[model samples]
Target chain A: MKLASATLMLSAARVEAERLGVIVCVSVVDAAGYPVAFLRMDGLALGCIDVCIKKARTAALFHMDSADFARVACPGGGAYSLELTNGGLTSFGGGLAVRDRNGVVVGGIGVSGASTEDDIAIGLVGLAALS
Target chain B: MKLASATLMLSAARVEAERLGVIVCVSVVDAAGYPVAFLRMDGLALGCIDVCIKKARTAALFHMDSADFARVACPGGGAYSLELTNGGLTSFGGGLAVRDRNGVVVGGIGVSGASTEDDIAIGLVGLAALS
Candidate 1:
């Protein structure tokens, strides 16, 4: 996604986060798992910053929601231990891939700070802004 | 620095990179060595993503340009082998500290995906934008 669009999405996510009473770190990455834009809200935990970026990268690189990837990476699953292989993949609820109108994967969004469900919800809100 | 200001710096760096006809990855980190923003231009090498972040983190954590850190970390120097101590420090050009008017370091910036000299020049341009 273009940087301007990515920044718009991030702004949308930030609004959602404020409504939810949470301070979080958000990241957007292109299809190749490279960052397009990132934001760490004031007062957020420093650790969440990197985690947010990695989550976005994991979604973009895998072309799937991190929650779904978590299921596949669970013990006894075909992709067990996959998270350990790529720098550090985040197979959690907060990461989501962004798709174009034609369903082509364009980028990804990752949100961190709140509960898993809230993170996922915020990420979805961010992706929705892209549409 | 705030994410907004960091994004401005990244934008300035992108303009410089475009003028040089080189694609690059840029990263900004807060005083605690946590990412505030990042961007990788389209078609740039994917490998530079993590490297750019690390470089920024290194600069922020050490409060010095990566090139100067290189001199200190070189073999026979007082801080030899220091690069391997952190997660992985990049002791080279392209990483620089960002200080506020009070002379306090607010953050750091790192640029990658070009020759060392070009990367350093681009990072400097980015820093200059903050002023």
Candidate 2:
């Protein structure tokens, strides 16, 4: 993804998190799962930082929301143990593939430091900023 | 480091790399060694991405240029085998500690995808942008 797009996603996520009265870390990665932009709000727990990046990579690498990927990677699921690969992956909420104007997946955004539902909500807000 | 400062550094590095006629990956990290911003320019080799991050981390962790750290980490040197202690580290040129106006170390910038000398030069340009 272009740096302009990644910065917009990160800014949108930060605004949504602030509006929700919670601190969070957000990460954006290109289609190849390399970091493009990242922000760790002043009050976010340090441990959640890497989780945010992994979630974005999980979405970018798999071309789906991390939560959706989780369903397929769960025990007895078709892609069980898939997280073990790709350095590491976070198969959970808060990650969403970002698509371009043509609906082509170009990157991903991830949010952490809130409940799964909130993280997902914040990430969706970021994704919306792109379109 | 604040996101604004990190963004400035990344932008400066990009401009320098463009002027030098090279594609590069640049990374900025906070004092604690967490990534702040990163950009892998179009055409940058994928292999250099992580190296860029590691270089930033090495500078942030040691509060010195990675090239300077390399001198100490070399075989039979004081910091021999130190790179293995951190998740990993790049003890070579291309990474430099970033300081605030007060001369207080705040973060670091790292560049990759060019000769070590060019990488260091680009990173230095990034550091200059902050001042």
Candidate 3:
């Protein structure tokens, strides 16, 4: 995805975050799991910055929302301990893969610095901006 | 620095990288060494993603260019073996601290995936954009 487009998506996500009254760190990564864009709002938790980017990387690499991947990475699941691989993955909510109109995966977005549900909401807002 | 400004810097750096015929991974970190932005050009070496971020983090935390810090981290230098600390620093080239007009450090930028000199040049392009 083009960097300009990624910036627009980040802007939209930030608006949603403001509406939700939560500051956040957001990350965008291309389909190959390479970072395309990232933003950390002022006053955000420093640790969540890495988590946000890792979540986006995880979503892009796996081509699935991080929340869904959490199930697959759970105990007795096929990909247990997968988070330990590939630098580190976030298997919980808040990461979503971005796909083009033809449904081809283009990138992924991850949000952090809030409750998991709110983070997921913010991530969806970013995904919406792509479509 | 704001994410929009960081994106502008990344865009400018990408233009310079294209002119140089090199693809690179770029990262921006806040004053506290927290990641604020990151990008990897298409076809860039995957290994450089983490390296670029680490370089930016090192620059932000140390308040100096990675190339300059290399001398300090050299054997018998004041900060020898410093690279082994703080999640691993990049003492070579391609990382630079970002300061405001008042000369207050606000962030840092790092570039990787090319020769050390080229990386440093690209990093300067990004820094110039921030000014």
**Fnat value of model 1:** 0.03
Please give, for every candidate in the order listed, the TM-score of chain B alone compared with the true chain B.
0.96, 0.96, 0.95
Candidate 1 chain A lDDT trough over 10 residues, lowest sum: A42-51
Residue pairs in collision within model 2: none
Predicted candidate 2 versus true structure: per-residue lDDT over A70-110, tens digit per residue: 98544334333345445667878999988788866687898
Report clashes for each candidate as comma-separated counts.
0, 0, 0
lDDT of 3 by residue, A64-112 (tens): 9988877766545587767556766776778898888898888889887
- How close to the true structure is residue B65 of candidate 1, measured as C-alpha lDDT? 86
CA error at residue B128 for candidate 2, angstroms: 0.8
Model 2 C-alpha lDDT versus the unseen true structure: 0.83
Native interface contact recovery, model 3: 0.00
lDDT (tens digit, per residue) of candidate 3 on B62-123: 66788886885544343333454455678899998888898776888999999999999998
Better of 1 and 3 by DockQ: 1
In candidate 3, stretches whose alpha carbon ends up further than 4 angstroms from where it belongs are B1-131
Q: Candidate 3: what lDDT?
A: 0.81
lDDT of 1 at B44: 92
